[model samples]
Target: MDVKRIVLLISLALVSYLMVLQWNQDYHSPAPSVATSAPAPSVTTASSNAVEDERLHLGEAPTPAAQAASPQALIQVTTDVLDLRINPRGGDITYAALLQHKQRANTPDQPFVLLQQDNQRTYIVQSALEGLANRGRIQFQASQSQYQLQEGQDSLQLDLAATIDGIPVVKRFVFQRDSYEVKVSYLLDNTSAQALETRFIGLIKRDNSVDPSQGEALGMSAFLGAAFSSEENHYEKLEFDELRERRYLSEVQGGWVAMIQHYFVSAWIPDAQQTNLYSTRTDNQGRNIIGFKGAAQRIEAGQQAEISANLYLGPKIQSRLEAAAPYLELTVDFGWLWFIAQPLFWLLDLLHDFLGNWGWAIIVLTLLIKLAFFQLSATAYRSMANMRKVGPKLQQLKEQYGDDRQKMSQAMMELYRKEKINPMGGCLPILVQMPVFIALYWMLMESVELRHAPFMLWIDDLSMKDPYFVLPILMGASMFVQQLLNPTPPDPMQAKIMKMLPIIFTFFFLWFPSGLVLYWVVNNVLSIAQQWVITRQIEQQGTS
Candidate 1:
């Protein structure tokens, strides 16, 4: 083996492997296929015992057996961007689907369901008063079973009314025409002789199911679990397993808690001006829960007070997320290279705005990156060409110093110096660019903008693997040609391994997203072109 080449290969492999392992840990198993027909929402809530232990300051009593057993009515609400079901029992959001995003690229009519409570998965949002004893079991009544935004309407509000301990309370869910943030508020009519004191608690409870929005691809997976922002920390994440091991608790002013999966996220943004308590715990049914409770509010007799919070349920679109809450956009994770990835994504998004196509945007972004690093790449290619020019001389030196490692090393170093070539010149420049490449990989993997995007013929969804396997093949062919332009290793074993790299990489990329594979194919082709021209010039100079 060539010591330098072997070491470089091992180093690259180690870095890539570590990155993949980290990404795998961030994700769970592949999500079960979306059901053809939606199932009824499950009637579930956090256990009373678990809530008492957490000391959420929810001074509530046990749920009445009769109320808990009764079949709760589900109120359906439809807006321009949202279609969701509200359970009148706790007035929880039992199911939600994004009307704009489809469950599958081919199924244009079926909207992508974000929160559902059925046999396969259990993810729902709950909001209730902290002081009321029957908060979780209140059978609120709605004026209608279904509500839809009018043709010219810009917003819609659905109210579920119930009396808790003789205090008339109304839970209202407010939805806007083109917004994903739903305002959930409690209207307290304190008509009794005494004052009504209560705090608003909003939470999201979900089971350990894989991210249904994630595509089945041989690529880095997105992070799935609970994330929140606090006064001490801008953003923090805990995996389901980690949440199970220990409880997470924090107190901050104006923070939000969220359940994140792949491209979509559901978060509860509490009152920003007042301090709130945030926590995470598992429910009786093993569902992970993250929630926050606002500061206590006292409603004097014959007074009306409204306590409200925002529930954002939709894609991780940066603009929407930033508007939803501070640090909420961090949920669109791009790994440790976010600094580079964010800029790259910004440029890609800008290009997409002009081109109106993600595939073309990616190609243009790759070209831009190549242009930015043109000088560095040229230097690297020039070094490789010089190495090719001295290949014959290096082979003669190896043969002359056979079985004498020290002399062979000295002879190769002398030849390289005499030729004014740096043996590591090509590799160092490429190594300097690895962080950018890895950052781009993460950016492409995590961006929902490219989810169902299409390129030219044979590629329908940029987020899905290429059905024809054409891009990977082209990528492999380009890699082979690029290798041909470089100096071949003198050792037979090393040379054979190098020859197999393209084949191995092709198989590895077979299941990658077409958008990602397209980028690779383009990059490889460009590199080959640059290396070939430089190699031909060096060869001509040698002959002359």
Candidate 2:
């Protein structure tokens, strides 16, 4: 086989391997059997019963009360970007829908619900003060059932108060405009003529239900699980199966636990100064529970104490998440190429800010990448041009040594040495750049900012595949053009296979996100332009 055919086969093999690897990573074996139990009560509470303490020590099974759908009033709170409902039963955030992000590109009126508690599923953020009898079971009274951020208001605060054993406890939720993080504070007033000992337990309860968006794509499913961070392990994923078998127990000064799904997340970030116990369990309703319990604090008589934590409920915006907590940005996963993907996303974002268009920004970013590797591509193109220049001579040598494999190989090597050509030089440059291209592909696919962004006519929603296969067709055309400008294989079979690659790639790209296809098309066009210039220069020099 000729050099071009060999390169084509290698490229196809590489792409196939990557596709299989990605498929395995995204959709592994089904999770282990679902374990149903009630949410375990806290052991640090002073009023815990003997059975509760033994269960906590031996790893408790979920209680039956967790599955009871008892009726309770929900308080609605609306901010600039978020619409939320807090359950007064335990001050749990039961429902949260992002007002700015819609459920689909075509549906502007419907918002994306990130957290909710319904008959089929339950996902909520909950926190309660431990040590009091039935703290999480107690009822709290709110000032109002509904609260909205007024016009021109920068922030809004809602308070829920409950008197437990004469200790007045107030749960405050502070929502800010243009932000997804809610500041949750638990204030305890000790007015019973004695010091009160208590600790705060914050957790997220989510059922083992899949997101509707997970089935939207043909290739890979989005990651859905429980993840945590600590000083020892920067980030760790705990699936429902793992929680079922055993609890993930850890003690860290500052860490967070989160329930992450496609495009969005909800985490409980406790105070950084105090030590907290992070763990996970399964509820009786088959819901997964991941959370942290803060260390105990004493409140003197007539004195007040406040413990606060931040609840993040929104899309996985990397910059904002990083500001919220360390390594939190990692929720926007890019697989193993995070180092390269992160910087690529930064550049893409920078370009988007300057160009104000995601599609155009992708094209510009591709151009910049090509320019950065101009020298390497020029060398590869020069090598290909030389091979094309000597194509006739190589053909003559093959015919001269017909039916003699050893002689043909020797003659081709002799010819290559005489012509000062490196048979492998062209492939080296492409191999060196494959990682970056793959990284960029993943970065674009995982970016939430491009979810519903539109480019121009006929190309809306950069995150989804093209409604029509126009971009993929243009990409294939560009690829064919690029092949035409490069050296052709002497072997008939090899040449035919190389010619079929564009067709195969077009079909493969049809399912890819339009933003990624746009990048590939732009890169191919740029490569063709550069190769044309270099090939012309080489041909002229050879004639001279």
Candidate 3:
């Protein structure tokens, strides 16, 4: 491929990826739930003779003005310990509540005095779904931090005991309380050792009262394709075209590794990982709803089945994640990523480390990549130029073959055979570059570092659209000019339609991020220049 051809290809691919990036942001998932349906207890018992509204306030006191309030109908759960931040926009929990998490002053999603709940709450939200993230939280039956260690060593004994039914169930969640991954060593030691029989089960339940219609901006939808349609533009309620979702699970040494990115929550699970405290939702309208209940099995006395797993909770970064295991990075599938997608994410990670900025890193990497592929691109341009020069000959052949499509194909093949031109020679470089393009798409999409990241003028945020529409306009202009430079078969009707491609492409890219447009614009400019030079060189060679 020649430099010009590479530039053109890069431009086109960049434009396509930009569309992908935009799609990821469209469906915004809210944060994880707080507790089951409970709100934090209040410090003061506000009794204004408030309409016998005493039931209106359940916790210790009422919701403080400075604190983000939980829904009025807060019900205290007696399950697992969880802390959550109540977000204002959708009345959803923006952050998760963890073990011993009594009160939080401030969090990533919200900054305010978090509402506190004690034992149980009488106040319930419109539905339990929207109130899952806050105060009157639940507690896991078994806890590791509560476990006492041996005589004089930090090496703690796996001490766990709980009652599932009339039968006493004892098992240790062998993991650090704060960590996402752990090993759950289950020992159904029939203390009686009298061959007691009972069913072993692992289950998490959601509040049945949750109302899905109470929330908005559910999850990413139709990001896989539908954006190209003329009918897709009018719909705002649907997922914006660039949203992405990925779930990666793998078998590792002792247990398994998982990489998960849902709308509101992102998690990475590592091998030998276990957790007794897990939060789940059962609302019909929640985006990316998940529920798992392991099959019930009868346990033999004094026997054990070791279950291990590694879990990660956060953004999709390659280095931080792949360090967890192999192929875990695939959770950030850009768009039909192939072999090189993982490598591309790694490269982006390397660039991010050096440059300390993902947006700039992507730009630098793209530039270097363009330079590296200079030779292939140059050849592609040269080939295209030759074809452009032979336009008259190919046209003549078409006319000569007239109504005989088979003869035209044969004549074209004969001409290529005589000229030593491989009919598919130009496709190789393009095909080879597809993975890199796909990887880059996810690189931008999954990189939380690029979220709200700003570039130079007219592009305040690499993750968002160009506020002035200047970049998109330039993008369309570039596409149009590049299309002009590339030679097409002689057909007046086809040429006219091709001319409309820029306008069409421009409309799709209007809401796309500026960094993507910049890449396309640069690539297009380079392609135009390369095509011009190659065309000139071919003409000179022909004359000689």
Candidate 4:
């Protein structure tokens, strides 16, 4: 076997392993449903248990206040890109729908709902003052049940106020017209004579809800779990099973905890300047809670203090997330090839900005990559053309040295040395470019911008596989043509395997996203053109 065949086999093996791993991860029997009841708000009065200095345990259920307040109403907040419902009880975000992203490509009117607190699925953002009271559970009062950004208004604020133990605490949520980040703050007025100590804790509670996008494609599954970053580890993913076994704990000056799905994510970004303790745990109701607690702050008598945090609820747009917090863009994961994939995605985005169409942008990106590797490809093609010229000589040697394996090998080496040809030359260039192709594959797979993007006729969603499979068929044909241009191996078995590759790849590409297949089709067509030209040039020189 040649180096090229060895490399191809290894690549195929790695891909098969990954596919099995993904299958096992996605197809496991579903875990039993956790109860979806919201926990009662805990009140920490002067005589209550002294709060832990920095640690926030999951198993500790705070004592509910004896005095039960009236049920607060739910407030609705709307902006250009987001429509959210906030429950005044605990001031938790009950529902968030992204207006810009639709649930289906054909159904543009239906917006994608990211966070919903319902019987079927329980996902919410909750915050509270750890030592004094559970602000998330307390019944705060909102002035209005509905708030919207009026014409010419750039920002809107929804305020919820409550007096806990004579301390007036105000929770404010600020929303901007064109942004998905909400600024959440707690304004505390300490009127008592004694100093009050408390810590601000923000958390995201979610059940292992099924991802709606999982059934869209066969043998594909997007990540659905909790992820966080800290000073020790830049990014860490905590699966639901792992959370059940052990708690995730870390202390960082500034970091974030997020619940990430396929296309969307919601996160709690704490104050950047304060050292916070982050942990993840499951409540008695079986809801997974990933939260962070800020360092304790002492408020003197008659003094006021404010604890602020940012909440991001929207699609996984890399640029916007990076602008929101440090290392936030890492959420758009590209696996181990991020270094190459990131640059390729940037170039694709740049091309889209110029071309104004994702399909054309992919073609242009493929053209540019081919141009960049033209010289190396030309050398590879020249080597193959020379091998094609010596095909008859190799066959004759094999016939003469039949049944003498050592003599056949010696004759092949002597022929190659006399012709000054390198058997591995063609394989080296292909090996060098394989990583670039794989990186582009991942970039196309993860980009949410292409979710419902249209690309000419019959290709409406670039993120989904082609409905008609036309691109994949053309891609297979192009691969066959390109293979025909390359010199056939002297070994019949190897040549037969090479011939079957195009058909095998075509079947594989049929299930890939249309955008990925389009890229491969364009790349193969360009390679055929380049190889044909080089082969013709070498043949004419030999004739002369």
Q: Which candidate is the best by lDDT?
A: 1
Which residue ranges in model 2 land beyond 4 Å of their true spot? 1-10, 18-72, 133-136, 213-215, 491-493
Clashing pairs in 4: 90-136, 90-137
Give one digit per residue, the lDDT tens place, for model 3 in 1-544.
Answer: 1333455456666656555444443444333333322332221212233212212111222242322344432222111223333222212223343332212212334321112222221111110111111322211243322233233442333434443323344333333333323233334444344344322122111222222211121111212111110111211111211111221111112222221322111232323222111112222222222211121234455554333233343334554445654544444445456355556666767887898765677677777677777777777777667667667887898788887767877887788677666544455665666566556655555454454556666565665566787877887898787766666745555567568768977776666656666666666777678778877887898899
Q: Judge candidate 1 at residue 472 and give its lDDT.
A: 88
Q: Give the TM-score of candidate 1.
A: 0.91
Query: How accurate locally is residue 241 in candidate 4, as Cα lDDT from 0 to 100?
Result: 62
Task: Write the residue-wise lDDT of candidate 4 on 471-507 in tens digits.
Answer: 9899989989988888888887788977987887777
- Summarize candidate 1's per-residue lDDT along 1-544 as a digit string, tens digits: 2546866686559555844643454454544332222222221223333344343533343332321222346788999999988877778787899998989889999999999887678898887787673344567899999999989999998988888778888888889989999999999999899887878888788888887887677387578899989766888988887776677766668989999999999999998998777777665455677888788899999999999999999999998999999899999999999999999999999999999999999999999999888889999999989998999898898889998988888888888889999878887788888899889988998998888888999898998888989998998898898888888887777788779878977876777889999999988888887778888888899999
Task: Measure candidate 1: CA RMSD.
Answer: 5.4
Q: Return the lDDT, model 4, position 131.
A: 63
Of candidate 2, the 10-residue stretch with the lowest lDDT total is 50-59
The model with the greatest TM-score is: 1
Off by over 4 Å in 1: 1-3, 14-72, 133-136
Tell me the whole-model lDDT of each prediction, alpha carbons only. 0.82, 0.80, 0.42, 0.80
lDDT of 4: 0.80
lDDT of 4 at 177: 82
Candidate number that wins on TM-score, 1 or 4: 1
How much is the lDDT of residue 489 in candidate 2? Answer: 75
Q: Choose 2 or 3, whichever is better by lDDT.
A: 2
